[model samples]
Target: MKDVYLFSGFLGSGKTSMLTNVIKQLKERNLKPAVIMNELGKLPFDSQTVEEDIPLKEMLEGCICCSGSEKTEAQIQTLLLNEDFDVLIIETTGAAHPVEALDAVYSPLFADQLNIKGIVTVADSKLWLERESLTPQVRSLFLEQIRHAHLLLANKMDLLSESEQAKVIFEMQGINSHAFILQTTNGQVSYKLLENLQATSRISKDDIHSAKIGKHLHLSSLLIEFNKSYTQQQIEDWIKTLPSTVYRIKGYIPVEGVKNPMLFQYAYGLVQWLPEYIKMPAKVVLIGENVDEVKVIDE
Candidate 1:
């Protein structure tokens, strides 16, 4: 049976970075790895991060826990039938609830063919500290992800001071005492640690059914396509004008005077722009509560 591992985290929690590291380590150990990446947007921005050699599948435009369950099953079946890999890694959308996502993977069609390892949840140290500021529904989803994790990563430790790190660790441990917690920078963790992890005994189909968790959160996404190039300052100024309800914004933006569009990521008021050599679509996907109603570009 092939081993299956799930990666769960909120937006901008460094899941893709962790997935990249895990894939590199797995390859070094002579183990073939396959990936299933879920994205809330139509464009597969994160899927591009996976290497070409690895067998990869993408489920887009929905969260795996809700609208994409059937599609996820089909993708898994396709990989199992055509790919030769020792392990399968599923990176769920940040908005996905862990238990529901797990339920989606437990399809009877191929349950016996795979060994479900567990979930590795990445928690942003700074976000955990300021979770109280989030809307109640969003905060609940954030905590639920950690609560169901078997191995939790307290990521972005480098951004915090020593005392802040201690506090974040304490809070995370307090919430999920059973999970093996690690302080990490850029989502780095030992592959051996991941290989040895066991699924949390608390996660069962019965619990998931009893909870009846659904995609009830008011969160929505908006895709913004740029018609013309804009200065970096103009984009940054517009981002600053956004309300706190916006959780994440990511995609490529056409920057004035730049040959290629830059990758932009904004999460919880923090903004980052990375230069990309290859030109990508000049579009951005904004994910948040009532995001569809928000005007993305200033007229």
Candidate 2:
């Protein structure tokens, strides 16, 4: 039976980064793996950043909860019929509800051929504290994602103080009394956590539409392409000028003195960088509401 792993999290929770690492681990074990990335908008940047060789199927313009269900079914059908893979990983958008994605996968047609290995949800420690500031519908959607997970990754733990981490863990346990909560930094998680897992979900398709209660988020993507190398201070200065409205920023940058290209990630006011030796173009994609494209470009 082909194992299916579903990853659900809020925006900028590091789902793509963690999923990429998981795929690498699977490849190391000689396990054929395929990826299905679901994005809320038609223009996607995460798909481009994933591993090049893994078979990837992109489900765009909607989350699997409502509009993407039919497409997801079709995509899964194609993967099962034409692709030779032992495991499949479906990375849902941050706005996605895990229950809906699960219902789409458990369709009658895919019953015998596929097995749900686990439902892993990445929780942003910084964002979790700010959940109360969100609209009622969005806040509820965020909690539902955590409540339904078999494994919850409390990511960005490095930024939290000891007391803050304890409180986040305490609240998470209260919300998801049964889930295995793991703390991680930059989404670096163990591959062994993905093995031999079981999902304890009792959610019905009818309850999954809770995602539609809120208005669709008004979001846009701004792609900035630059071939010139930047100094470390120059990169930091540029990131500091980014507006608060821009929630997510990720891409690669070539540094003047560094041999490897630097990977830049900014989410919820946290800025992180990692040196990547791989060949990649210098560019960044900014996703958020009311993004000032001109100002972002000028910076």
Candidate 3:
């Protein structure tokens, strides 16, 4: 059976990063995999970021809603027919509703060719708490994404306080208690996501135990692209102005201070600065949850 993994999460929840890491891990183990990413923005940065070329494709335009599914399935079938790989990963857009995205491929058209290996969801610790801000439609999608997954990666674990992290975990576990839960930073937990099918989901009755997503902050995530150079300290000091409610932040930022774009994280008053960019411009995304903060801060 071909393992088809769907990396589902709200926008900016480390889905693309995790998908890339999973591909790399598969390569190290001598397995070839194909990637299909749905991008909300104009750029195809995620497909380009994979370490070594294997077969990468992108479905860009809109979120993977039912309207877009028919068109996307045509692409997926093309990839499966043209490329021979052990696994296929579909990374959804930040605004995507996971259940709808799943329905797109899980349709009778493609379901026979792809075995549903797992649905791995990467959630930002900071953003997951502000579930209240989402419109009823999007919020329904968010919880449905969690409820349907076989695995849940509670990413950006480093951002939350111990108590806060525990509380979110308790809540998530309440959604799909049967799904295996793993905590990660910057989508680095490839081991937990791939090549491990320990068992099947328990299908507990509580998977749909409704919880109110009230009073949560509405978030607008932005991927800031820099055509000009920026100093490292400039970014450091700028991040200080962001509120503590920031759920998760990641991506490459080229520093005037250094050659590589430093990976930044602003959560729970902890800022993680990565070594340097191995590649292009300082592209970083800021996702503020339940934060009455700025829309997209650009340099």
Q: Give the best candidate by lDDT.
A: 1
Task: Give per-residue CA lDDT, model 2, range 1-299, as digits (tens).
Answer: 88889998988998988987888888889999998999888787889977777778997787776567778888999999888899999998888766567655654345446667668899999999888998999999989888877788999999999999999999999988767899998787787887846431111121112211111222333445555677877767777776676666666767898776688767678888898877665666554433433253222
Off by over 4 Å in 1: 200-299
Most TM-score-accurate candidate: 1
Candidate 2, which segments miss by more than 4 Å at Cα? 200-299
User: Better model by TM-score, 1 or 3?
Assistant: 1
Q: What's each prediction's TM-score? A: 0.67, 0.66, 0.61
Cα lDDT, all candidates: 0.79, 0.73, 0.65
lDDT winner between candidates 1 and 3? 1
Question: 81-121 in candidate 3: lDDT tens per residue?
Answer: 89888877788886776545655554333443556555677
Model 3: ten consecutive residues of lowest lDDT? 199-208
**Model 3 TM-score?**
0.61
RMSD values, in order shown: 16.7, 18.8, 19.4
TM-score for candidate 1, please give it: 0.67
- When 2 and 3 are scored with lDDT, the better candidate is 2
